[model samples]
Target: MVQEEKIPSHVAIIMDGNGRWAKKRGLPRIFGHRAGVKAVEKIVSHAANIGIKYLSLFAFSTENWLRPKDEVSGLMMLLSEFVDKKFFEIIEKDIKFVVSGRLIDLPDEPRSKVLKLIETSKNNTGMVLNLALNYGGRKEIVDAVNKILASDIKDIDEKVFSGFLYSPEVPDIDLLIRTSGEMRISNFMLWRLAYAELYFTKTLWPDFDEAEFDKAIFDYQNRDRRFGMTDEQIRRGNI
Candidate 1:
């Protein structure tokens, strides 16, 4: 069992290198995407089983829209199929599914599936599974600002500004994990990941199994999240 005090309240992941995995195997990129979905399934189940309060997966980004049409189309189909196949299982496990980003960019089929998942998972009281589709950190901040400007409240702080984000119900990210050795944040969860501990691994998305995930979690538990306080201040529990 995880120590309650050491568990990260929120964890975010950037699932990268699906295309590279497929290419290395002399298979189509879509093959890797399909495999990556399976990895997602395994990780989500494991995270919930471990009592992780929040898990965010970077499934797609705004930049991903610039990819080849055929590849993009395949990704959308895979997403819809994943929802259709996993919806019932999610409900049975009492896991809440949440999505971040603009739904306008999604096709009707996947959009419908995503909406259905969010609607169905509304009452679930367990771990939240967040998907970042067509999402960008800069865009999120811009949207938040636009919302703040449109409102009558002249004074704006971090707490009030956060309410305009896509999934304000979810708290700030505590741990951010990116696979395939990527060092960049790639414009995901800009505001929510401000204080998140970052973990980077060379394992591709399809290969990121429970063992790899556990390593990340274990490392997270070993960190000293002082949040800018002095060592003495934190030791005294007065910061």
Candidate 2:
């Protein structure tokens, strides 16, 4: 039997279409958000099982604050519930939970819960599951720059600035998947995805499952990631 191809070191996702999925079903948008959480649980477990070292999910964006208050509150509530319900299972699985993006804007309770969860899972040896909450790509880059400027180093290189970002140890994204037919990155991991392969699907987040994920991986495996080198050079160099 053929062995499965080596799993990607890191994978990022733009979990879009929750609101649209809800509207299509004539249900409250929060319902879609709630269902999306189930998808998160399934995908994370499968990712870990399949040997994906790092998984990043765009859970909340900085611009998400503009959404309806009820929806935002519901999202936070779901986050709390997820933490309360999954912390032990996550620890048992040895999956490390990490949060990216701004923390100051998050309400005290949710912020505290996130901190507790991260602390509890910090030493886990399994996949690193990163939740991008209150996250924006441009804002993250700006924050990294500001942090670099504040440091003692006079000259800043890309490597130096990158080390200041939220989680410097995480590898650059290898594949970024966006569900709901979205074709854009939507300010999710702008710097980190500089060389990442992107996959867009019309399947809504609620409907996205292991099969869809496998398709994305299959597509990624077929890509010619030459980066900047010529095809002939890559062919000879065994990239």
Candidate 3:
């Protein structure tokens, strides 16, 4: 069971392995993507119900654009449909819908829908659902730097630089969950995941459920997040 007091403020997930899951079941990859969307709906609702402040999902990466045209088109269509269907539900649940990427890169219809969702939910006082669509961790850093260079500021630190991120309102990730047995971050959130507890599951994204989420939370609670402190210092509450 997850300890309510210790619930992570921000949880980021690298939803992976839709292709492999589809292959295993002798179905098209799009089928797996569709199933993954169902799992996303379940997780988003559960996260909000569990008092998570921010939930960041790696929905689409900038690199993902290199995929076959048909798959990409299907994904775009699916995304548009999802936004259309979930707009009302997001409002009803008081969830803030936000995107953390180059929104202009999206197709016209989906981009319009995404913008509408963000505008509509901007004032929601509930959990933030941050979708990393067409996002790249390295690109984010580069863009931040470019913005800094364009400014007149001569010097800055990490804290100051963070304000230039795509979703600066969202805090650093507390726990990062990667599914499909992946052992890597895959350029998800390089800056924000600096000290996050990593939880990797072999379960495919389509199969990840509330139980799996709880298991990850349970594992996080058991670990000692000493950061850079020694074990003795942690024991002495010298954090």
Candidate 4:
């Protein structure tokens, strides 16, 4: 059995291919997205069960607004439903809820729901569930830069600037997983993923479950995280 000590402290996921999954099944795209929420619930429980401290999910991106209006509206409705149905479960599990992204742009009902959930879960002690809604990696970085420039700090390094992000309390991403065979980061957590290990899988978001998640964890266990040290130096413990 693999040692549980090797499990990553934080895992970020780019949940993709919902529409494609729906198309493959000859169902409406919204059906796939709805199903994806179920997958989200399952994965959250599994991550907490396996001792992951933080799980950040890229649910919607800033660029997603360019899609058809109907689709966007549908997504918002689904998000509202998700919060209404899952907030209790999240609280029961002691999972703290947080949201990243341009939340001011969301509609009033969904925005209010998100805020309520965050407030309700703020005191929880279990895993953190960070939902990236209307988020963009580049946008987050740019916002951080703007904030730094606007502040009174004389000099701002990477560490200093990171503190100005949406959730500065969180640590850097330890592992990033992108589903549906996507090899790119898709503008997700560009700054935070500086040293994160990347994992890609062909499984689509709606179909990703505990088994697939375990596979990613298993793969992560075998990696050599030298962090730029030469192989021989790493082996000899000589930095």
Candidate 5:
């Protein structure tokens, strides 16, 4: 029998190139960031409708703090505004909003907004929308290691270690998509993306709409995952 196309249980995206998008139009970078917000809303709603269980977005990274102070400030304000505006709508849609990273590292206003968003959506039983803010892949690994070291348990394996990460409830990523033509992982989620099918597009994040999102999922469905098994094994349905 011909194998049916598989739907990924979890999808992660590195939203890149907002600043570049704004620069090309001779507009402030914050304008691109603002436009990216609408794209985010469209993609999230579309993903939930299409039966994707988990959607993790790399919103802000540890390295992003190295940007100019004004830009960082603008980003923080935008994040706060996003939460305030979208919290109730997401709850009504039965989507659970989650933020994973060093929460304390964020400014007071954004941090408070994030906490409130999580609290209000905590009861929802639906697709997860995970925002990785002030997050780094290597840093997450180190943090997990520290958690394991402090514990009394002796068992150390992939499953056990995964529980120590910031967001352990979510499963490993099945597909990872990066926009703006970026070719690197950029420390988004090191451990979770081990065997994920990767997709890259030249389209900037601000302009990445539902059609672009559909294309990413379509590309992912075409990938044949072996998980270290031989091609013959896969063909024989042994994987």
Candidate 6:
């Protein structure tokens, strides 16, 4: 059982295997993406109920643009529709909606909807729902560096550099869950995942549920995070 007090403050997820899920069913990839949206709905609600303070979902990656044009357009449409459908629920639930990526690269419809979501929910005092659309960890670091260069900041440290990130106020990830049996981070949250506990599941993203999420939390709870200290040091409360 996961302890309530030990619940991770920030949980990030790499939602993968949608294409594979659709391929396995001999259906179009868009169908899989559609199914993945439903899973996102379920997991978001469950995360709030389970005391997850911050839930970041990697919805679209910068590399995803290399895919077929039709599929890309379809994804944009889906995102716009999803935001429109969930706009009221987000406000009513007091969820703070945030986006971690370049909104300028998004299609006009989706970009406008996303900005609206952030603006409308700015005052919500509840669990934060961060969507990583068109996000690449490497790109994020580069973008931050460019900002620093433009400001003519010669001296900088990790702490100061972090403030330039797309979502600077969000804390470092505590738990990172990747589905579809993928073991790689794939350029997601490069800076924020410095010391995060990673959990990979064989279950596809469309099939990931509350129970699957709990299993990851349980696994995380059993681990002893020494963070470079010896076990004896941890036992002696010398962390």
List runs of model 6 lying over 4 Å from the truth: none
- Please report the TM-score between candidate 2 and the true structure: 0.96
TM-score of each: 0.97, 0.96, 0.98, 0.96, 0.96, 0.97
Candidate number achieving the greatest lDDT relative to the actual structure: 3
* lDDT for each residue of candidate 6 in 1-239, tens digit (9 for 90 to 100): 87888899999999999999999999999999999998999999989988999999999999999999999999999999899988999899999999999999998999999999999999999999999999999999999999999997889998999999988988899999999999999999999999999999999999998889999999998898888899999999997
Residue 118, candidate 2: alpha-carbon lDDT = 94
Query: Per-residue alpha-carbon lDDT of model 4 for 1-239, expressed as tens digits?
Result: 34599999999999998999999999989998999989998999999999999999999999999998988999999999999999899999999999889999999999999999999999999999999999999999899888888889988787898898877767799899999998999999888899999999999999999999989988988898888888998999975
Clashing pairs in 4: none
lDDT of 2 by residue, 60-169 (tens): 99999998898899999999989988989999999999988998899888899989989999988999999999999999999988888788999878888789888887
Provide C-alpha RMSD values for all models, in order: 1.2, 1.5, 0.9, 1.4, 2.2, 1.1
Q: What is the lDDT of residue 146 in candidate 3?
A: 98
Candidate-wise lDDT, in order:
0.93, 0.90, 0.95, 0.92, 0.91, 0.94
Report RMSD for candidate 2.
Answer: 1.5
Q: Write the number of the candidate with greater lDDT, choosing between 2 and 4.
A: 4
List, residue by residue over 137-175, the lDDT tens digit for candidate 5. 999999999988999979898999999999898889999
Residue-level lDDT of model 1, residues 95-140, one tens digit each, is 9999999888899999999999999999999999999988999998
lDDT of 5: 0.91
Question: How close to the true structure is residue 66 of candidate 4, measured as C-alpha lDDT?
Answer: 98
- When summed lDDT is taken over every stretch of 10 residues in candidate 1, the lowest stretch is 1-10
lDDT of 3 by residue, 42-93 (tens): 9999999999999999999999999999999999998998998889999999
What is the clash count for each candidate, in the order shown?
0, 0, 0, 0, 0, 0
**What local lDDT score does residue 132 receive in model 4, on the 0 to 100 scale?**
92
Colliding residue pairs in candidate 2: none
The true-versus-predicted C-alpha distance at residue 107 of model 5, in Å, is: 0.8
The residue-level lDDT of candidate 6 at 23 comes to 97
Q: How far out, in Å, is residue 187 in model 5?
A: 0.8
